[model samples]
Target: MPTTNQYEGIKHIARITTNFEDTCEHCKEHFIDPATATNHYIKEHGYKILYIGPESDISGMEHYHWTVTILGK
Candidate 1:
């Protein structure tokens, strides 16, 4: 699927669900893509990357990062 600059790192994640089942913690918006979720926090709000989900050692890149966009600026 096509992604915007906000969610370009979707592919870089080790384990991210492509299903838009996930909901935003702040806006409570549903998205089928993880990138969309990340972008939502970054664009809609003003959150920074506190930490990228730790990389998976067993699977190699299955880990993802959390967008603290809602928690803080």
Candidate 2:
């Protein structure tokens, strides 16, 4: 289900993890931390929704996949 950002009033829920090797889908750059990826998405891409997979997904060393969607047009 799509959830809203309580702080920014955006429409989407962001799932952050300790997975440090994640990358930004927009910029196609690897991030050492999820928060940095999130900030880049918001400050640069203006994205509202960032859905990250479960911990097991990252722990398994699977390919990182983030589904991004912009909210409020």
Candidate 3:
């Protein structure tokens, strides 16, 4: 889960402690803190959903930056 930054700027904050492999499958990077990592994900990969903009996903839209809420919704 996000664990941090649940709604900071558009994020749905969730915390994660297990399933490191799964997280890797989704995003191939790690951060010491939620603020840095989430911010990086948003800036590096995120895209405005429809110009009107609501949800944001990973960098590649379908690959690098996945938008799945598998846990801790």
Candidate with the greatest TM-score versus the true structure: 1
For candidate 3, lDDT tens digit of each residue in 5-56? 5444654333332213223224677654534544454465552221121234
Pairs of residues clashing in candidate 1: 14-61, 14-62, 15-62, 19-32, 20-31, 20-32, 47-69, 53-64, 53-65
Per-residue alpha-carbon lDDT of candidate 1 for residues 1-73, written as tens digits (9 for 90 to 100): 9756655434322223442257766677877777777677678766555444433233475754343222234
Clashing residue pairs found in predicted model 2? none
lDDT of 2: 0.55
> By TM-score, how accurate is candidate 2?
0.42
Task: Summing lDDT over every window of 10 consecutive residues in candidate 3, give the lowest-scoring window.
Answer: 47-56
- Clashes (candidate 2): 0
lDDT of candidate 2 over 1-73, digit per residue (tens) = 9987544655544344563466665567777776676677677867654344444435466666453332221
Candidate 1's TM-score reads 0.43
TM-score for model 3?
0.29
